[model samples]
Target: MKTINFTQMKDGTKEEYDFLAEMEKPYLSLTVDRVLTELKNQGEDSLSGYKITRLEHGLQSATRAYRDGADIDWVVGTLLHDVGDGLAPQNHDRFSAEVIRPFVRQEVAWVVEHHGIFQMYFYGHHYGWDKNAREEFKDHPCYQSCADFCERWDQSSFDPEYDFETLDFFTPMVRDVFSRKAYDPKVIKENQVFGLPEPIFHKLS
Candidate 1:
């Protein structure tokens, strides 16, 4: 009863499959812990040439979003948007998006999935790549949201001197996000474009 008796996919009984599902609940519940651990690991090493560590970059991005009056989904999505960079540098945006897609709004996930291309507007030209490559998604509802996310949070977050919140400050928000029922349509809000709030600091400035 402790383990599924069958090695082959076609051989498992319903009782064994149910047992496995039951066993997975604890692991699934610890998603937030695993994510937090990865974020902490990001702080242990700096990406070459960047003035700040990846963890700091994420903290800055989340702080900006939180200050902008973004909801929990937006703030958490922005925080983990680069989590995939450690393992999948080539297409980290999409990979990061998948990591949160099940528990967040569809609009937020879409922005995360495409933020990489949208970000090219900032530095792709230095290497002779098309800076406007993101134009291909101009018609998508979340395009502007993604652009703003990159401009306001992602691209502007490398400053070492910026006062960013610590990972502990965002731990509750992260736990709240990951605790949601996975893929709940009520939570996903497909095609709903809750775009970024006007920058709070902009008004102050």
Candidate 2:
């Protein structure tokens, strides 16, 4: 595909948004208005070709995870998992950890950091960089934490629409983008045990 700003891509569509406008806002009620706004305002085209705006991808992942039955905290972690992308791309694992702190549980937030390793594996495979995936993950604190995160909870326990009232967090703005996310293979596998057939929600992939 043509390389263009996520908001201004090959289709010439222009979507203006700022993902961090709500960074300073309190997340006391977990309002959909607040969360959905954050999703829309954020741009999606990757500044660094090395990856997509991780925040955008994380939001998609969380949405997919939640729609399939992931818990609230896990869903929350998915949304904020990569907020640190621009500020600390290489170190954004903690950036995500830091961003999600005020709203989610310490343990689930820890899992957000852990997601990096799994992502590196997934991304690396997607991008054809198998060798470095391990090196990149080797020393990260999130690595160990994620292993436990996966083991502590199997994918089956997650429910996609658990706190659907929070759909506002993803609706109007983020849902169009979020809904397009194809379910993660691991995520799908867990749900498949219960007969959740994977469906293509987006046309892009």
Candidate 3:
């Protein structure tokens, strides 16, 4: 069938649902391309008043992580860490973390999620905020990693003179990372993956 007949999901037959599911898988597989495009557009809206554009900063962070011998996941995480800046600036850290959570290790997600709070150490005091705000999480297992990310990648990535790699240099790596089974059963339970098209049901119900 060209399209399902039901306007509402409650009227959908099992075969119709399965057909829709099969059709969706290919679009779902394009998540990586969509994410990379979003990252590429990071500098178009606002430069955030930094010396370098968001795209440059992201590339610089990833370049440093790769040069420092980080694994593929770490490099990708650093590269797209500011991706959330495009849509959600205040909670960009969490947004970024959620975007990569399905494809990366839990540790990488943790670092991405908390890097914003950790980054406050660099200039929070300048803005009348607490520079030591990150200290509250000093005992967390990923605390040091987040702090190191802020120090070595996130915070220090604003230098315009840095010899950073281009977004093209990291495109293959992004695809590799995103190609992994999303929300792996070993890391996240199979049931928790929301394994089917809930949106169609919920929205059309």
Candidate 1 per-residue C-alpha lDDT over 1-205 given as tens digits, one digit per residue, 9 for 90 to 100: 8788899989999999999999999999998898898889899854787889999999999999998899999999999999998888899999999999999999999999999999999999999999999999999999899999999989999988787888989999999999999999999998889799988864422
lDDT of 3 by residue, 119-141 (tens): 98888999999999999998777
Query: Each model's TM-score?
Result: 0.97, 0.44, 0.86
Runs of candidate 3 exceeding 4 Å displacement: 185-205
Evaluated at residue 142, the lDDT of candidate 2 is 47
> Candidate 1: which stretches are off by over 4 Å?
202-205
* Candidate 2 ranges beyond 4 A from true positions: 1-41, 48-56, 123-205
Candidate number of the best lDDT: 1
**Pairs in clash, predicted candidate 1:** none
Report the C-alpha lDDT of model 2 over 26-98, residue by residue, as the tens digit.
4433444544444444555345553334335544555565665655556656665666666677887787676
Candidate of highest TM-score: 1
Ranking by TM-score: 1, 3, 2
lDDT: the better of candidates 1 and 3: 1
Worst 10 residues of 2 by lDDT: 188-197
